[model samples]
Target: MWHPGLVDVVYATVAGALLSTAVVAARAGSPHRTPSRTALVAAVGTLGVSFLVQSPAARGVQNHLVADLGQLTGNGTSLVAAYALRVMVLHVRYDRDTAAARARRWLVALVVAFVAMTVLFLATPTVPGRFTSPDAPAGVVAYYLIFTSYLGATLVSLALLLGRYLDTAGGRWSRLSLHLHRAACVAGLIYLAGRVVALLVGRPRLEGSGQRFNLIELGVTILMPAVVAVLFLLGVLIGRGERWLRHRRAYRRLRPLWEAARAARPHAVLPVTGGGARLRLYRRIIEIQDAQLAAAQVLDAAQRRRIDGAIAGAALTGESAAAVREAALLAAGLAVLRDGRAAGGDGGPVTGAADQEVDLSAAVARLERVSAAWTGSPVVHRLAAPPEPANPR
Candidate 1:
């Protein structure tokens, strides 16, 4: 006779937790809903179901261990099937809504209640050893059929989901999901093939009042669920990792942009060169000009107007406080623009000093030319696509 020992119990418990976690995560990540609030409740029912199969409480009074184990496993098999079906359908109808996200929550709660009640009902059945009467083979058969129906529902739901995904998402992503989707479909097919055969032939008869074929059924049962779990987890992990890595890289790139904007004062555009190079060096000139404009804004109004007019008329050069001050202004602007500081702003330009003229009119002219050139370019418009979670491998 087969026995539900420590190893079997432990494995079932752990598997229950893992499956629950995976299901909850997938649902939570769904666009339509949040995490299932009562995922633990569903897991508890699954654990209880597993435990009953592993350790039938009526082993002493009703040594019908096969019936007990078969019923429990069959029921659980069906429950899991129904869960899969619900997940698939819910995902399709889903919109990240408060109600939709609670899909598993309420259903799981009912399952827990049913499981608890079943445990109580089983504790003291009409017959001492058997949960069902010898005449109840029809009911037992019907129960198995219910589970089979759930599995069928799950298969259809998955097929629908795959079709919808292909129709909506195109290109490489379509190809990728198809890989996992096909694998999962095959796994389901394997399960259906085995279970349908078992249903038609009926559970194998035992010899000598011991489980002769229970072990065979158990082996197939464990194998199918295990394979499905592995494939599903593999797909989920890869998708999640891809999304996270892309987000991390993008954040690292943009981080410096934000930091630089905060750490220094703004300046005007200026350039060290003129002519064609001005267009190429526009970023540098813009940085310089922004700094110059900021410095001017901080100066007294009269001093600012006078210097602005002087620079407008001619360059900053000569040999006196006037020329030196204007050259200093130009130098400070260029320094801040190039090195991202206010160093040369207060010092002097490379070639000109106090009482010298440093022409900036050309820099101003370049800004307009560049602006017009940009404005004259042909405008191209395309539809905006939704952001991708991650780039395809």
Candidate 2:
């Protein structure tokens, strides 16, 4: 059997992680009211509350009434969480109207189950710690049965939904989160099954059966749900980490281009400051776009055609070819500005539709390509070079 102190430590750790995950999810979704975001936040937040109320530390000092109330609250919240998870998956898998209809039916069923469990608990005679004994009244047994049955069913349904969703999930982080949630559901089912067996067979008899039996019961009844909690926490962390890394990577990739743009038109730089990686990237893209417009004003048709011909002859394609051409044009314009052959146009920045309509990710990707070509492309290098000085005969 596991040491009692070690079990307490594990339980405490899992509870803390669950609570942290809930807080993070709530904050992350605070700005959005999309069905998927709201459902996910509700699911995680309720699950965290369930575990917190049922924790050993919280239950240790409670009187009989308080303990019973805590148990009912924990079980009710857990059921709600299960339903919310199902709704979240539904929103992901089906259209909003269909998902909403199905979710309403499930929510009604959960409410009924919770009410039945509460009524059964209240009808049972007052016992210390409420249902701690194997010989507890039939009312207590019925209460547990309803709670376990409804929760088990919800977990099974959630697992099935997640399995179907997993097959079609395209993003790496999405698949990972689904896999973690599916594993948590399986662990929840195991915990519920153990609750059912213990309720029917008596906990004392199971403990007296054998050391091996006791160990198995302890693991299934206690450790299984802890595993579920940890899995939920991991799912939250993994998704957050993936998004942070993507934003940070995009910010880094755009740095060289942003620098070039700043050098070319120092006066056009925006005065924005103090934001996260994603916001910084947005600012950088806008500044680079402003510089590109400035460059466009100085270049005549011949210079534009020459840059395009050079890119085409170099056998580049797609965004890379376009990026190289843009880089050459910008460099040539900057050269002309330096030589005083062409005016730098109006000090006021020119606004264009291309910056407003392109998707942020696509814009970042194209600019990243341009950044690479600006520094490394030999064809761009030749075109960006200043015109040769005239020779006198």
Candidate 3:
């Protein structure tokens, strides 16, 4: 009985779209970005052109042969979008640098193609008829042929690319990529076949065959591709969803253990037995896990490893790890306090200990309670990373 709100679907779709778009943006930065995303964007655009551009031009088609000249003209955009998407998907899947270059070349080919389609529609003559109107019979045929040929060419090339990719991908990535590409190809073919069917079937509506054909086309052709599009999109989303879910589940699943550690410990402050008040602080800094998730006890081991790696990689990446180190140190200081060493309020003044007014006991108590009452019931780790200077260096 619980249905998702309209906003939820919209947000999910938008997030999916954004996920694809981010790949495009990343493609711009990293040649390693998959071309499948680019193709998906284009595939959607091509279908959009049929509904958004061509369908609207339905008016006046009965009277004027070239009544919807603009609709025909708009084929240019669809051609470019579809071609790019199909080609890019192949390229990404197959690691085809040539495909990228070929994509640019084919884009130029589209202008030439449109010009040819326009000239044929304008000059060439045909008999006045029902669906094959004389205003531009040659144009229509040429357009169909060109579009069909494009589909054939694009599909074959993509199949080749996919074949090459399958041979190379070898394992998990290959399996996923293979499926994604296969679905994409099926989607492309479905749309292309639908358009082809519509043109053929729409020609005879007056004979009753036309209506039947249109109906059949709508189901068998039109919606078939739409269905394929839906499936393809779902697959993409499922892949992303699985990744997101894995991280989330891991975090949730591991959360309890982390929190249990904190719960079991009677003292929150690190038991600072030596002048090394900084030691506890250091441990806290490392265990804090970026002051966000670990303290809240929702951090997963994967996330923990990621944070650890980030810390490890900071020097290589030129990122400052001081803040993370500082949080760790603070946590460690709390640990020391629980050990009764910080009885003198931050040890009465170690070099960097008295720098801040953080309530070690209260902070840990509040945080521990939060951990105990976690709705997610995630795990937290004991802080152990060495602390940085309390004053950021």
Alpha-carbon local distance difference test for all models: 0.44, 0.73, 0.47
Q: CA RMSD for every model?
A: 18.2, 5.0, 14.7
TM-score of each: 0.45, 0.75, 0.46
User: Candidate 3: worst 10 consecutive residues by lDDT?
Assistant: 342-351
> For model 2, where is the 10-residue window of minimal lDDT?
344-353
Ranked by TM-score, the better of candidates 1 and 3 is 3
Question: Can you list the residue pairs that collide in candidate 2?
Answer: none
TM-score, cand. 2 vs. native: 0.75
What is the C-alpha local distance difference test score of candidate 2?
0.73
lDDT of 2 by residue, 1-393 (tens): 666566667766776776677676566422225787788778887887777766655555444445457677778888888788778878877899999999999888888898898888777756445464455678878887888877787788778888987888877987898799788888888788776666677656756566766566577656788888888778777867877787789888878777777776777887776766666777788888877777767766666677778878889897677778777877787776556675633332222224555467677767777778888999878988546446988
| Candidate No. with top TM-score | 2
Best by lDDT: 2
> Considering TM-score, which of the candidate structures 2 and 3 is the better prediction for this target?
2
lDDT of 1 by residue, 203-313 (tens): 333334335445555544555655655555455555555544433443333323222322344322232353322232333443534444554433333433444454445
Which sections of candidate 3 miss by over 4 Å? 1-39, 42-46, 56-66, 70-74, 90-99, 124-138, 159-184, 187-221, 250-393
